[model samples]
Target: MSDDVTAWLLGDQLNPTLDVLADADRVLLIEAHGFADRRPYHAHKLTLVFSAMRHFRDDLRNRGHDVTYLKRDSFGDALGAFLADRPETTLRLMCPASHGAAERLEALVDEHGGHLDLVENECFLTTPADWREWTGEHEPGRTYRQEHWYRHARRETGILMDGDEPIGGEWNYDEYNQETPPEGWRPPETPRFEPDALTRETHEWVTDRFDTWGTDDLDGFAWPTTRADALDALEDFIERRLPAFGRYQDALVAGEPFLAHSLCSPAINLGLLHPMEAIEAVEAAYAERGVDPGAFDPAGDGTGVGGTGDTTATTLAAFGGDESSADTDTTLPPVPLNAAEGFIRQVLGWREFMRHVYRETMPELARANQLDQARDLPPAYWDGETGMTCLSEAVGHVREYGYAHHIERLMVLSNFALLYGADPAELNEWFHLGFVDAYHWVTTPNVVAMGSFGTDVLSSKPYASSGNYVNRMSDYCSDCPYTVSRTTGEGACPFNALYWDFLTENEEFLRGTGRMGLMYSHVDRKDDEEWEAIRERAATVRERAAAGDL
Candidate 1:
């Protein structure tokens, strides 16, 4: 390591413990405003990034590192000024997850007579080599399933594993993770971190300088901006929410936005907290509680040892007495095998899977449009003007907090867009701008390949569904003005007609897809007159959606 070397850190690469920064005593951080002008990003997203960067800079300087923090209009301007002063300076950076970012940064540095070195990004648990070994000469652009990769990761990391078998004797607990909350149930309170003076100043600056989207109210801002705050948030989630997280991970309720969800994605994705930190926390919590994974019977309904629905009582009784009456000191609630496995699968499985998929399939993946959907996203998405309860609730969450759980993103927001035939690229842009957790690597594969079915690289068929799916997974339909049963005519749910219409419109492509045969069977049972009515209703829904009057 040369004394002349300076580490250039991107906004997302805010972790102080990254290996790339260990040898460098000098650092450069740029807060360029030009990129924010490219899209109308959420005020919270902008504030979180900039405030985190500023705080990281202050922290580095406090540790006796030389820090050059630039607030310029563009990276070029900032680099040009830095390089003009120290021509031929050497810079080091972690390879960014966004495609072509490393090459572009190298070019910019080279243009200014500087040498650049790229290092492995330590934010992720797995490496490019891990992906390569997992794929093992598989053809690119083919479907890569998450389950298989998830199993491989667990085996490699020895997470929740007993010898060669999974702890629960199952690779997936998704079937057990879909239960909605019982009546009168309320989720644990969402943890909030009050903004410090520095964050408040950053928020004010962002509101003043940028034409941002989403709610402008700083009172609703709740993301963690520092490593300490992130660690606290992670601990809070592991203690209070992880127990019930898997049971209702997919459930949607009106006016309840953060139901047992970790809310750690913003921190982890921003590098304030590393992925392993979160994963290990959950694993350690499960281990310290002394819950035996072998006690869970995959053949049972997951309510208890033999489907009796008294998992806590059974486990406690096995230890000596009933949990309520036992003399032993009360520990935190035992983490259900379903909950532990489900949350781990997200970080160790799906999150890693999304990153690698986006890496291998970018540029074309950004432009992929296999479904040929070209309609602009409806006004409901932007303005939250729809009478559909699911759409309104999900959009309202995004507008207020730049956040929504995975189910709301997939089942509510993206599901409706896919049913209505909205363009995948436009939807991806909306996700990128609206979510604090969303980066190019996170949103591209989720919105384009999985959500919009723009490509079959990650999924074989679209995640298209009718109001019935929503009605089953959420309570949104109960209070909704539209009828869940009707497929056409007045007051009929827009999703019902649009879903069938989508299938019929893209039948040539969708009918042949895997797992689509069952849906097409229903499609075949409809009479010509019924399809005609569905088409008419779908057309009316599209018209209303476009006009923002739905």
Candidate 2:
């Protein structure tokens, strides 16, 4: 709490209003370059982080605070130079989300003869103590349920809660969140922030100085780099996209990349906007829209129609009185219970749960490979040269923009990798380098655990699936070169054969796991000839994938 203490801010901890900065008038920021050389990160990721850090420094200086900004190759050199003149200076920083970051930073500060104080990171909604209180004792290899933790978070924080129960009388509206968009449906325009002088300069620097992956087109750069722009993006999402976000949250379209998905992850992950700020903004929008929870029937069959009286009428009327009609009506309906609940669950439930799970299960989780599949990732993942429409589109999106919707991440990109028998750790590295929102903490659990089923600590089973799931949830199969109906022989969808082959290959490890009986039942029904054909097709697919000829 000393007034003489200097506050050191990481690139991700760009929020100026944090309590850790209140007592210190002098701020230190370092734009380190050594980390970028460690991997070929996306150009947009480097641009956004450095530009946001520069902007935060200016914002603080303009507010009458003395700031010392350093451009160095490493943090050690930066700290050494900063502490050369002022030895034993106390440097305060928020605890970073990555594992062992605080200890590493503290050790660097000690090496430089400076004192370091780690404060709670306010960018997230939950605390380490909150994670501890919810999960009383950590048992090794025990999986924690996200639903139970989600409810616990709601009860503890009173977010989207009516006294003790959830506001909608249901814990989740996942059933109503799977519908695909109607024919000729177009999503709302994604808001893009035109780069200002600083961003353009930073973009140029990132392009010249680093050998980065992904597209280097500044014209298509849309991520926000300032607090004000992040707020605008948040407002834009709530106003224009949130209404239909739930119904089509899981759907994948041919040309539509940002379908009702909030592009707030990069900004939130960068600390330009706090997680609570987004959750509260969404909660406020739902309250102001005056949606009646009674209109949503929990017993109805997933669809937000027919069982409810006026709800169906109102929803249909908003879309020109036909469920399949593609009329572009400007009149926005009240925010659906499913949309509101779903968005809240993402920020409050799943995001928080991922963080806590990573915190508790790391070191081992980072290297966990329960399935032990060790095939190299296909070249198509890097080059986007696949004939399969789903994988091609998903990888192309990541190659063009450092962004893709959660479904594309889970079902398309990671699902393909999981089915194809790619190593979980290698896939994790690909995600970490390719995405703007991905951090070690974020991608480790998602790609390794949830996506690859490397460990059952986060999920019960692998997210492996054949073309049927993709065909049902998306329109990719309609235009794909491979046939969805055919499981073997020529021009068969790769997912079908790989999926069955994966299940058959790993039945001993997966058959007894949670909720996998149905999948195994299908596995049980295949005869010797069918299995032989599937094995042949799967082998062919792997060979083709490895040769980059698929």
Candidate 3:
């Protein structure tokens, strides 16, 4: 191996990008056991990464690439061992997704190296350098909104562009995507990919080695672990689910885990699907001759977590197949505008925005606690043992699948935590460990910046909500033990009381923030006795949650 060029690949960097493998003679793929061991990473999350890495290694070898594979304690240990054997071999690396991971690799190179070359990661639509160029005048950590950046990206890339003006005379179609599921319509089933022999063995080994939070049953391991499989999943989503995805993007139904959503995030984040390639495919589908794009009044897509107006009723009425449109043909391409636009916004808009914000906030995001929340994350988050049907269902979904939709993450999980004053950093750590698609770059902006408001500058307002919102958006509250309608007395929903308590507690900090004036006005109207009652009830809820009895 003397003087041989080898690319050191991380789990996420599984693609055969030219920078990593086009001219490289050898590749080094490491399974860092110590990395997974330290975090409360879900069993399935571990399985997905490991299985994908193993498969990518096999694929490269089959294509005549010399590959060195190591299942070792840590990245540091793996690099140490590899370098000890081949001191003269040149080690090249793609820049890692996280700042911490990049720093760790740099430290490894300093300790033991012949020559180390850092290559730019090519999985994302925009590079860090591109991000710098995009936000040239603004300093890092400034309060720049995603809508502003999204508009710029639309013009720059010409995605959904019809000349200088956007298609349908607007940049976004989010108004049509935020709706409740139609009463009789059902969502397409999320396709599942079973594990092969290699995946099975690696999964069993991971299940035995680490005490992760999610389900240990390998039979449920159906995530795409190879590039071919990931592509298949993407195609399946476009054909079977994309038509319905926009209408009910935010709605939640009981016993329906993958309702009209593209479950491609894990694959995309893992480099099995390139961002531009995926976005282009979705756009191509929209432009397909047979499909008619749906349209509504043109407006800019609002901040994902804090969309400007209350679109609850209008969106719900529209997507739920309002009595008139129910009979009309939605089957044919002048207009399926909502589905395509909703997806484009998620992929090209929100996804890119999150990464951009992450690049700016990096090392600081790890320690952010803007809300000054001091309480510990409750046991229910890891164990799926909550009494509230919404929380229980969301937690159980995570335990079984290692993932939940954004609505579940934002509304049920983070909303509850925000109400209870759970530490944002602790919640962020939980997000990092628990999901299959979560990496520091993804989770920091999502969980901290969007979900919990742990760190700010992305979302304009806290996404805190009462049970009323859940009742309207989901079916979970229908079977809940607590009454979704009540805010006081016996059998009141915990979220109702907790929501009021949170507003009262954070009123000082929330006073000047733009979207919170009406909420504070509501808080001010509550009598002292009513405020005391809400606080007292919220304390009970927190106490019960702490003891794992709720």
Candidate 4:
């Protein structure tokens, strides 16, 4: 097995049957300190990745692959130092999938004057060029927008489809995705497959290594690190959660973290499961139930489950803001197209678009700064003790579980950080540090594109909003002491003042935006005196945030 003397393996390159593993006598997998040094990544993220890497090493060793798992505790670049002394062509190494890893390895080999073999990691469905073509139209002057490009990707990928046409005669079933769950109606209970001894042991090891690595309080943590566990998690989601996922995708509850969430991103990003197959599993499950994905009501179709009674599959597009009496007895107008469109954009448009953006711009895309907002990350991001209920809960959840649903991510966490003008790098680092599934490839784009960084480009405007927005979307405010209605008064929620302040502060940047028009209209309607009061209140909130009073 001399041909297998040296094969480069990455932590995420977990697929055992990959071509790189072929004929390798001694596989070199690095678990470097530098790799985990980008930011104070969440403890769960560090634990999940390191534990998984260790498990992969063990599995490879058991399978007869001579695995050299380097520990930074004793060895300093053991593989690189070993190769440096050997003849130029004696040792062989494979290229890594990520740009950062690839660059680091290339530098090592070049410095040591050793030979290496680079091969493409054939894991993703779309090539880097495909993402480039989608985003290429907009260059230095214009940036790529998510919706326009996402549709193109949909047509190209043929997911949820017919021949050259979208399934259900529509590219997106977004209209049904609006309408908040009825009050007192609870979402389906999430399936929890508590970790067994393997995960428990991994957690203990991670705990011992990085006892003080993240925010205070890390205990009873559990996330699937091995391939088998990850698959089980995906299957659980497909069976129990996928049916109502689209409907409650944006809903948020104070203590409930997994409301109709797929919870598969960690697995998908970690190479435990492929995106195509994971998404397909959900799609297939829905099909097996004969639930017409196109016609099924995202808002429970008036069924008396998921906390509401049965409703019919009436297209919100046709319904047009007319409140349907099919489900709840409450009489509210049909949900707005604006909200519906925004929700849909996150999934069919933005999510898909970010993938293309990552593929197209990587190494370069990660550095793009549209807003140019630069500041060190605020301390509150790391410390869960921040008095702001929404921020504290959201960050706390991420710290403890390495998880947060989309609503908590976008409307709650991102909104506050942007309003505070937190450094994108800091915000990016915080997300990377805390989330179990967060990686540079995913975290960077989400933070930059869908969240605050995109001014007028991918996002029509900053996703900035006040405490009132959170109050509307979730029950988090009910437990909070601060008043959502207050602007500048004592006990006024920080978000209330900051939201208006953000609009007023960034007026020139946001004035002409179509999305900003309504907000501007409200701002305009406010008398000059009222406007002053709001601005002053906002100033107080910012000052308090700066003073760490919030």
List the candidates' TM-scores in order.
Answer: 0.94, 0.93, 0.90, 0.82
Candidate 1 residue-wise lDDT at 345 = 96
> lDDT by residue for model 3 over 1-550, one digit each (tens)?
3557888888888887545687787899988888777766899999899989999999989988899999888777888888898888788888887876777788887787656778887777777777778778657667768898888888889998899988777777777777776454566557779788998898888888887778888766658999999999998777656766777889898888778788999999999988787778778777762133444321212222113333333333444534334322232211266787778888888888888787777778767778888899999997888789999989888888888999999999999988888888888888888888888888887777777787667777899999999998987887899998888776889999999988878878888787898888888788989977888888888899998978
Candidate 4 C-alpha lDDT tens digits along 1-550? 1232477666666656666667665777677766454445556677677777887787788888877677663223655566655444434444444446666666666667665677666445555567666555546434566656657866786655578875556656665554456555566565554655665676566655564345433453556777777788877665545555666667676666777676777766766666666656544553344334323344434432333332222333334433443443222212222223233344445655665566555655566556666655556666676777888888777767888877788887888888776666667767877788776767777886667664344556678787777887777787788888777677888887777777777788778975788888888887888777777777776677766666
- The full ranking of all candidates by TM-score, starting with the best, is 1, 2, 3, 4
lDDT of 1 by residue, 1-550 (tens): 3357888999998888888888785899998999898878999999999999999999888888899999899888899999898775688888899999889888888888777888888889998888988897646577788998999999999998989998868888788788777655666677889999999999998999899999997889989899889999999888767777877889997778998889999999989999999999998877765354433222233332223533456556555657777433234456677778889999999999999999888788999999899999998888898898989999999999999999999988999999888999999999999999999998999999999999999888889889998899888898899999999998999999999999999999988789999999999999999999999999999999999999
Q: Find the 10 residues in a row with the least total lDDT in model 3.
A: 297-306
**Per-prediction count of colliding residue pairs?**
0, 0, 11, 12
Given candidate 3, what's the lDDT at residue 13?
83
Task: Please report how far candidate 3 places residue 42 from its true position, in Å.
Answer: 0.9
For model 2, residues 1-550, the per-residue Cα lDDT tens digits are 3347898989888898898888885899999999998888999989999999999999999988899999999999999999997685689889989999999999998988788989998888989998888788887887988999999999999988999988878889898899887666666678989999999999999999999998987877889999999999999888777877877889999998888888899999999999899999888888765355324222233333322333444565543455454243323345777888889999999889999999999889999999897999999988999899999999998988888889999998999899899999999999999888999988998999999989988778888889998999999998999999999998999999999999989989988888999999988888999999999999999999999999
* Residue 343 C-alpha lDDT in model 2: 91
What RMSD does each model have against the real structure?
Answer: 3.9, 4.8, 6.5, 6.7
- In terms of lDDT, model 3 sits at 0.79
Clashing pairs in 1: none
